[model samples]
Target: MFILVGITDLPWLQKLLFVLVLFFYILDVLGNIIIVSLVMRDISLHSPMYFLLANLSFVDICFSSITVPKMMVGFFIKNTITLQGCLAQMYFFHFLGCTEGILLAAMGYDRYVAICQPLRYGTLMRNTVCIQLVLASWLIGLTTSLVHAIMTSYLPFCNSNRIKHFFCDVKPVIKLACADIHLNEALLTNVLGFLSTSTFSLTIVSYVYIILKLMKIRSSQGRSKAFSTCSSHLTVVSLFYGTAMCTYLGPSSENSIEKDRIAAVLFTVITPAMNPVIYTLRNQEVKKSLKKLIKHEHL
Candidate 1:
């Protein structure tokens, strides 16, 4: 049971944030939509990496939708959200968040294959395997989210109803409970730690292998070409995991609420919008496809 007070204290500042966030939401949604369209419509982009990129685009769209719309509404209205609504939001936020983390690792592995084992990549990450991996990420995300939601639902809120943060996250929601929440907090810590650490570790390992393989290339142009494609993925991985580590991987109490809120905004709001930009800028195939898409629409 909680009402979201949101981030700013001043009404004017809240209005400003609303406008800014609304723009971000629009950009995030529109950008992901374009990415999905480009990946699907372009036959040249029909590969394991683009397939996963499309999946990631869909995930980002859903992930940002879970919070940004509601958060923007809070600015103009009374900022009241029922307990049930809050729980639902919490469920989806974590669901998509966890899925994105796992998906990043999957994408890293895809990259490793493309760079390190170009010949066998087709055999290794066939269409069936790619579909299975995407399905697995969703299934794992949903199951983990359900467990977290159920565990959090059992906590006694008593009369407490005010959530300090803009969204209905587990950490902020659990802070309002009158009953003991040590178990809940511990569970959160362990679950989040495992999720972030395991996926991030995989990403790191994939990249390490990719780099080592690239170093073995004697041709400077070959190394440059290979590294260019990987640079976008690496940049995205760093952005997503860096902000996530700041928000979830640390001692929660060590960071102030303001800092935590800022970190949340970075990953939740900004990162999704940035993904398409990163890919489109760095990826020649994507850019070419997007250009054709634009031309097609104009025609």
Candidate 2:
């Protein structure tokens, strides 16, 4: 069995964090569920962009769900997790995290098609194409995470089994292994770096094309209208990538564990909770659909 150090050692702080995190978890689940339901139920949202957004929301919920509730339970309990359980947590966390990264890139490409190649958007981002993109993302994520989990499971853990984080994240868990983990560390860095860098490059390249296309539009209104459609996606990408890079790609040290914990909260807990608000507030179509749903319920 492995013990989780959790977010804090303070009794008072644990209680406080438990309540705060629980509230956010509930909000995250509810908000994402609403987005998914809205996309499926509303005919107006039956488009490639909304289809991707709904999938992103679903990823956010699952990603956060994998870690947050377990962390919350640790706040008030012994915080012990078995070896198998720890491995499972680490696997799914990376699985969803990687999937979200790829999905964001795909979404960026979808926006690029919608904005830069509007004439061919229908042909490029057809429903079949969007479905394939999502499936590819999931498959890639699953394969990468499976390798990490299997490799880590082989490491000999003869030392202390206490993981100094709220959950069984790769870095913290690997720190407990008695065997030489240079290979493990290298794998973690290379695999995660490749996934993050490649997907991020795709997203950035798509946005670069989008921005250049927007620049050529003579009318300010037309440019703003085009940019508005992409703003929410950009915001979400920023939030996710910024914190994730810090946690997985930054220089590692004894002191860095605390920083990793903080970064983990931002990407896992905070980002998921914020996604629904960011999309709904910035997305006119989503807001319109929500309002119509409310008005219909009243009638």
Candidate 3:
């Protein structure tokens, strides 16, 4: 019921980790709060993209809230979670991760409509459409992770209970299974891989056409501005999809534990932290709305 990784390190290092993580946790919480607040207050910001961003902020808050607090607490106490506790964490963690993936895909589709088909963008990404897309994202994510979680927990793990890593990832936990996890591996490959890769590919294709559309513009300012927006999405998507593909899609081997661990930090922790920053820094509308909100608050 104990974790042994780096526990022997100096007390100061543990303190540093706790302090650093606390700082980031605070920042992420505040950032997401401001994002949700700004998006809600501004009627002009009621578009589909920002609506999706708001949902992502909500997801970001939930996703990090699930793991970060536990991780930070584990640094001090027993750091040992019960078997059922482990299963619950795995279920929710996988669930949120899958949900976030679908939200990203939904965001890509939103962008495709906005950028590629400007004339009919509003009609295509109407309120009802947005609601349905968001609903579908939630359902898909929940269903996908539920299957994996059930499949994993139902299997017998008689060999070892000591998970080397911090979080309860399905593959790592299943790896400890004394029973055959061939089905888990197959599900991971066929279900998780197919869903994640397809979304990632769709995002890539969306951006490609957006870039081509930007190229056809005559004015340099118009082209630069269009490319700039695309660039921001590209940056965010690259950080997300790159880490994700490495973690889930790449070869499943013993060495992949650390790889996924690192990737988890990016996709689960840092990317959520970056979502607000992405909009505030890159998108002019979000910045203007934020400024207006602050001014009104002061008034």
Choose the strongest candidate by TM-score. 2
User: What lDDT, from 0 to 1, does candidate 3 have?
Assistant: 0.80
Greater-lDDT candidate between 2 and 3:
2
Query: What TM-score number comes out for model 2?
Result: 0.99
The deviation in Å at residue 87 for candidate 2 is: 0.5
Residue range 192-296, candidate 3, lDDT tens digits: 899889888888888778778877888999887766665556677777778877887776777887677777767766887887788789888888998898888
Best by lDDT: 2
**Which clashing pairs does model 3 show?**
none
Evaluated at residue 283, the lDDT of candidate 1 is 91
Candidate 1 accuracy as lDDT: 0.88
lDDT of 2 at 235: 98
Model 3 scores worst on lDDT over the 10 consecutive residues at: 1-10
Which pairs clash in model 2?
A: none
Report lDDT per candidate.
0.88, 0.93, 0.80
C-alpha TM-score for every candidate: 0.97, 0.99, 0.94
- For candidate 3, what is the TM-score? 0.94
Give the alpha carbon lDDT tens digit for every residue of 99-118 in model 2. 99999999999999999899
lDDT of 1 by residue, 35-113 (tens): 9998889999999999999999999999999999888888877688888888899999999999999999999999999
